[model samples]
Target: MSAHNFLGNLQTYTDGLVEEGKTPAVSVAVWKDGQLHLAASGILNVETGVEATTDSIFQIGSITKIMTVSIIMQLVDEGKIDIDMPVRTYLRDFAIADAEASETITVRQLINHTNGMSGDFFPDESRQSGNQIARYLDRINRLPLIHPVGEYYSYSNAAFAVAGRLIEVVTGVSWYNAIEERIYQPLGMSHAISHPMDVIRYRAAIGHFADQTHPEGWKQTEQLYLSMGQAAAGATLTMRAEDLITFGRAHLEGGITQTGERWLSKTSLAQMQVQQVNVPTVSKAFTKGYGLGWGLLHHKQPEDTVYGHGGVTYGQLSMLRVIPKQNICFAILINCSEMGMMTEITNRFLNELASLDYSEAQAKFVNLSSVEQKRFLGTYASLGDGFRIVSEEDHLVAYYEDTVLKTPVERYSLGALEDDFFYGFNRDGSVALELQFKDCQKDGRYSYLFSGGHLRKRVLE
Candidate 1:
């Protein structure tokens, strides 16, 4: 359970994957009481033969939402901004594809993704200044909506960019300075920067696409386009695993800076953890609902709650989870876009530390009732893709192109209802399926909606 042993286990898991040619590089850190536990595996710079280091910076991507959410909450505490007030009330230029929804959208809704905004249309220059971001607000009129504001969960980075611009309008300071003074510097996250354009010369990892023929390989993305939406997610900050641990500790300690600065009141931090909108549509890799800037996960057994955020870009993936009740927080950064790999490694690392057996948890889905078993026996299809799902006795599975089905048909319990659809939980008891079934069809399909424009579909075969 010690930090050293925990990190050693992580190194083994990530290194094993690296040797198998799965991940190029991965960095991990754990924090408790302002202390850091660090570990690294694989190469930081493959060409230079540089081993991954604690300070090796990788794009944290949408994890920048955390800094945005924290600063907004601080403003709320100071009465400079009201969470319920419409976003346009403060920034007159704010507009949405749907005029009515735009008029009603509030600051809290924007941060929690309850705003109707979808997709990234903020003309890459918006991340620079308030005026630049405001100029892009006119484009929202052409965007489309998946659902009405506050009605259903739909992730949108564009919404965050607009939120960031609103922050500048209210604070009269650059979004970068607000985050640095309020969140990063206060938390001692020195290496974390808002713009990748500034850090290109530093020791940072370039993202690579496994499909080399594709245009998104590491070499191609070395010069990613800068955006005015940087506040929403343009920050290409990198940090030592230890520094990230310090960042996690701030949330674990309820918004208290590592040096004892109470950046936001406990009540405001609590609001950040409240499940304002259900994200049942997001992937199993995500959780049940979204708080202000974090994902809300509910754990059974010992009965605990976790609040954190995750980010993914072209070639990197990052996750930060905080079990406040356990006084444990961990962050994982991988220089590969292996879906769920970071989550898998983080879970395995936590298992070793908690000394909790997962056998029972893993085995929970083995047995299936005749009725439950029969329901999965019919043909199923994904909504977006034409792929079909068929049941093989007790196992439900699917296949698309050359990818094969590894494991399917496990025991799952229904979680709460979100917009009339039920989400499923796996043996580890985390929400895994966001599904809805028709009695006539007898076969159900599942879709995971992770932030805006990111959707995954699967048929239960």
Candidate 2:
């Protein structure tokens, strides 16, 4: 079916989420071949009942990691910094709990999340002053290494915080200003802003906390900000789903924007997406290996790859995906800590767009109606999180949105694979994860996924 056909079901589907109290507000978009498909539903605020739109800005959490990496890549393109250089080269006074690891961590390791440092320290809790990130780096000096640098995969928000500091050292500007100057402005993303106060100038989404006492209700979350201290770790920058896809397109197009703006060298863009570390345990399953801010995703088949990132913050959640081979991108943003809404919406949308094939090679390859293609079309869930595996005309894709814990929901894409039994591969094709589905007439369908060291089960209803 054409993408527009899915739009018909989108409204009804989105209404179900809001009516069910699973989300407060949301904005979603998919971009391909220079065209866009968009949708929205729910309210921006639970109390105000402020209507949401495709333009509604959301706190894009760690999705900002991609923007941070973009700036770093811009610097790489300009020869202002080298990815392999030691972190100490820029922050000479910086120290971590593990002195040796702190001394040896490379810039590349920090971006790919293998820096071996404690990453979640949220100092400057007040989210104050533009100078806070500098202080954050100072506070970071006291942290011990989580593992040997370059030896393991650990998602470190602080690593990105330090990355912001390094951006400051290289560019002579605050990280937010650098992102605005280097990434957003060049791409012509007018509705995107990195700081909290600035978001007030636009139609924005207010994240609402899901009620702990009542699973089906929501209460307003307190206003929050991304302190200049933690901006790189995606403390909370509001963005429209459409604007993010514009950024994704830039990445898919090799650091070049649709308007012909050159954001980074093609080589630098490629460098940022290259798998730099193993992240087999990431719950989102978008990628098995970590790249810069991006994760390399293997679709439902071997050799199929895509790259993307996810975002999360208090009362907010986001997911982004980019298929470079097809120049296709999808972004979903929502307000509310209840991530089940994201799971429901993203799964249906991806499946609806499964037949999208704009390229000639892709058109012939996707042939959606083939018997082989139907084998993978279904919703598979594990541990209350949802994963959708569908046959895109060209390849099989495993779509995921995880809300197992914490603020941000994890949204991911994995390559779907099947032979004698079903399985999945990471974006770089390094890890093989088993996927088992069983039919149960009484209990509905069930999925058993082995991830994060347990067999997580999600029901298909």
Candidate 3:
């Protein structure tokens, strides 16, 4: 289906999310074969009565980690930085709570989120200065590691902030400028601005907190000025939905801008997608892996992989995904974050898109007879207990026990039994699948690697 048609469903999906009190506004874009498509539902600013448009910028939150990682990778490529070297070797002031572990931590471990870092050292608080973050890390590092370095998955904004400092120390320039000059400018993403202090202002979108329980009534996002720690979690970035598509396209094309400038080699981009550790205990059925600053979700369904990052801060949530082989990309941003509406809307649209048979859905599957596809359509069970796939209206849908998780089939793309099993979207619009299904059945069914460790359905029905 053309993006135009796909866009209609996206708007409807997002509109329903807004009506359901998930969020007040959202921005979404789809990029394919170098072409860009954008659509949004709701307002960028509810108080100003400003409707969300293609150009509205968003606080990309942790997604900024990718930018930080990209710059660090560039330094690595230049021999200015070493991935395996202890970070203290470069930033002499760098310290960790575990005196011995601090000496052992490498830049690579930090980039892959294996540094044993947490979201925050304090309870019910967010945002920290570089100095404050450094102090907090010192305190947290003393607390024994839940798992040894490179053995577990613990998302850490502090690790990335340390990375930002490393960049600053090595480049002798502000981390913000290094990113702008190296990544944003070369990619021609003029609208993409980092560091809340930048003078560039025009298309930026202010973030909104819809949750009323907080003392501050739904207000503008706090600026991250004079805060190097912001690089990891709170970097203020503003960009239209269209420009972000370009950034995604670069990854799709293997890390080179459209004009053919070699910013990063294909090898480097591949390195970023490498699973540093197996995140068996996260969301969904498939393994959630880490590659530098991005998240690698290998969905057993549709037999494809998605690489990118998702971010959240205050009332905003953002996501960017690059389907490397398909040369397709999607970006989602919302003005409000209470209740996880941004995530739900994004999942809904992507799930709908996933339901479409890429072979026939992408102007290719139209000829496959719906009857011929029925054998693959029966209610195959998923890895999660009581989760199964059933044929609905000639399409494959996912159900948890009796409750449908994803609606409408997005073409059941089965993979080699050895590689992947049962694929498509479940009712919740999440990428649905049962990875390593045969193995699970043989063992009397254990926990599904996905669904963050839940008993899986083993018997096929």
Candidate 4:
């Protein structure tokens, strides 16, 4: 199909999806075979009745992590930092609650999420004055390791915040300013902004929450951003979908900008895209493994190699995907927290444009005896949330509680896929969760539950 016809069809499909109330708004940018296509649909804000356009800016969430790691890699290229070296080598004062782990954690561990520190250490304050990334250390110092250092893959937002601080120390500039100077300007991404205040200069999209009580079945989110201090972990960065793919295009071209200017060495770019650690089997729906900052999709197939990142903050969710061998890049930004909608859109785009299918790969269900299920039944909890597994008639059910968000509890039915691995189905029978039990105790009960990128310990009564 011609690029013109493809874009027109995409625009129509996006419009129909939004009109069906899947989400409030969405903007997409696709670059394939040296051609760029852009499409957008729905209102930026229902309250304001502003229509979304290709230029509309939406929070890119954790996709900001790629920008953060790009800067870190630049430092690597300049010989100012080493990925394998201990993080404390550069940040002398760096210390977490586990002093031993803090001293031994490497720069590579932080970027790949093997540092094992608690992932969701958001400070109470918002937009604090003076080096917010640096000030994050005072709070992170108290966090205990959720897993042994470099032994497990537990996503850590705090680790990346520490990395952001390392950038400030090495460059003598705020993390925000460093990215703007090194990434945004050089890549010609004029539509990007790291601060919320600057969002006024563009047609910015406000996040939306699904509210059945509202007449429109959705309402604008009360909070627009997550904690500002964790900007390195994808808190406050907003940009147009076009600008996002621009950055991805640079990486797709092996770290060279459109004008043939080298932003990072080919070596560093390759390092960032290579698999650093394997993720849980459930995570393979989106990525099989993780690279330095990029999530490795189709890592085993070199000819079809693709790497990208997804971001979430407040009510917004965003995704960026790149197929290096095809010289293709695409970005999707939405103002509502709708994972299913995003997944469908991603699968459709990839199937049509790249001849690739991205459907979730589900494991076959294996029935477990009551004796087998008994060992896994219990409450497993993290700092802010937990899951209580109870045996139902034929399968196990997990009651999920969100302590931090104070949202209503959700329930999922668990079907054993193996001795310790299980896939969870929502009430609607959708396969939305995958979890594993690890670290069995002498008493025959498991000691930890790995789900949702967190390792939650078994809570005793």
Candidate 5:
């Protein structure tokens, strides 16, 4: 399909999703080569009934991590910091459950999420305490590490918290201000911002948690506090999808801003994209890993490596994907509770962009006998997600751990389409659930259960 027609179809689909009560608002943008296309649907704020526009801002969750870490790369370019240097060389107070491991943790390890620390920990800080990078690190000793200092791949939000502090200490300014002075202003990202209050000045989109069955399907949610420690999160960077794509474009072009200013040298920019650690696959379309703050994705077919990131703020979710070789990038921001919808949109769009047909390659049905299926039945978990696979009369029902389940939780009855691929009803939404099993041991032990590009490492069985 032509790019124009593809965007048209995307616009129609997005509008239908919102009008059909699937989401309150959605902002989508596609940047291919030098041209960019944007589309929006539904209201930015259902309570006020503000229609979303090309300029409407939505929080780009962990997508802010790339921004925060990019500044760190700038520091690297200036010789203010070295990626390989141990983090303790700058922050002496940094500590974890393992003293030896703590001393060995490097800036590279933290950025790539190989530091072995449990990445969970979001403490809300009042705006007045914005200068809090040091205070956050002082208490890091209380938290425990999941593995050793540089064992393997696991997502770490806490690592970015410490990274924010590193930025503050080296630059002689708050990490938040450093971001604005170094990133937003330099790149001319006028709509990009880190403060929640600053969002009020614009046509802000209020995140909504919708229960369609409730008397009123939507409930407005308060903006989350972006603590100083979480500067990496952009504390919820509210901005237009196209501008976000521009940011990604800068990285793709070896750190050159649109206005002809060179932000970082080609060497440093390449360092950011090079794969640092092999991470769990999140979807069948791409083999994902961590590279600095950006996600390093290896497309299964084209096998092209792309850098992108996904962000979440309460019920709001945003995603950005960029392929430098093709000069193509896309961003999707939605204010809703159904995150699976984001993947549904992204996967189809990606497949269409590549002119690849998933159905053609869909694995043929292969049913494992009841006795053989036992190996697939178990609980798998990562930091913030998990699922339990149980056999129900020869069929496998995956009880996903979700707070919004109709009962205690939702169960996805999966049927085999390929030897290791399965599809089923993905909630009440239009999207169907597709799952792939990978890295299984010869003895039938699987290490990661990937869906939506978020790898939930096997915690049991």
Candidate 6:
């Protein structure tokens, strides 16, 4: 299809999809061959009955991490910081519960999520103050190292908080301000704002939760944002889909802005996309590997690699995908927490536009022996998340718990895949879970469960 017809069909599909009640609102922007196409449909808020427009700002969640890392890279370009240098080189008093890790963790490890620090270390007090980064530092002693430093890949929000502090210390500015001056302003992203207060000036979309009790089958989320302390890790950044894609285009153009200005060095941009660690297969639904701040999606061919990130905040879901080989990038923003819908949209968008499919490769399913299955049947936990796998009628079922968000318990059935990996399907048979058991202990039980970008330890009863 021609580009004109493809974008028109995308817009029509988006309109119909929203009307199907998957989500209350969504905004999408596509950048291909130096042209921009945008689409929007549905209401910004069910309560207000306000129509969403192409310019409506939705929380980009962890996509903000890219901006955070961009500022850190800029510091590197200026010789003000070094990725290999220990974070303590700048934040002299920075220390975590693990003294050795506190002293030895480098800035690169923090950005690439290899620091082994607890991933979800949000404090209630941090949300109540503007000096959240400082409060986060004061409470750093509470977070324990989940694994040995540089042992493996584990998503770390605290790591980025440390990165944010490093940015603040080296630049003499707040993380939010640094992002504005360095990224938003440089890229001409006028619709982007890292601070929640600034959101009021734009046509911002309110988040919605899937609530069967509500008349519309969804309700507005009580909280509008996450803890300010984790802002660098994607707590409170909002932007129009257009602006989000513009940010992606900067990286796509190798640090050059749309107006021919150099926002970042080509060397730093290349380093950010280089794979730092290979993620677990189960987590490949999100990413195949980790870069500095980007998620590397390795397609069938090496040159077809795609760089992107996903974000979630309260009841919103956002995704940004950039395929440099095709000079194509797209951003999707939705107000409701409907992940299944987001996945569907992402697959369709990529397949239709770039002729690239991100659908999970069909794993060779195998039946594990009863004893082998028992190795994975137990409780696994990270900081605020956990899973309990139980066997029923020769099949494994997992119960997921989200303590931080207080979400309802969810259940998934695990089908054994190759090499201790499992495909988790919801009751509706959607392949929403990717997980693996790794690091066997001397007692024959696996020491860790890798899923959702977290290396959760098996909880011993």
Output the number of the lDDT-best candidate.
6
Q: Candidate 2: which stretches are off by over 4 Å?
A: 1-4, 127-130, 212-216, 226-228, 281-287, 355-461
Q: Compose the digit string of candidate 5's lDDT tens values, residues 376-434.
A: 77887654456788898888778777431112466787776654767656556333566
Q: Tens digit of lDDT per residue, candidate 3, span 343-371? A: 45555545555432222111111222465
TM-score of each: 0.75, 0.74, 0.69, 0.95, 0.84, 0.96
- How many clashing residue pairs are found in candidate 2? 25
Residue 180 accuracy (lDDT) in model 1: 74
lDDT of each: 0.62, 0.69, 0.60, 0.85, 0.75, 0.87
In the order shown, the candidates' Cα RMSDs to the true structure are: 7.2, 11.5, 11.0, 2.0, 3.9, 1.7
lDDT minimum window of 10 residues, candidate 3: 356-365
Count clashing residue pairs in model 4: 1
Candidate 3 at residue 431, lDDT? 44
lDDT of model number 3: 0.60
**Candidate 2 residue-wise lDDT, 132-249, digit = tens:** 8788887866675544677656677788889999999989988878888887888988899877768889988877787756433777776465455778889857789988988888
Q: Count the backbone clashes (under 3 Å) in each candidate.
A: 16, 25, 21, 1, 1, 0
> Ranking by lDDT, best first?
6, 4, 5, 2, 1, 3
Cα RMSD for candidate 3? 11.0
Give the Å error, residue 58, model 6: 0.2
TM-score of 5: 0.84
Candidate achieving the largest TM-score: 6
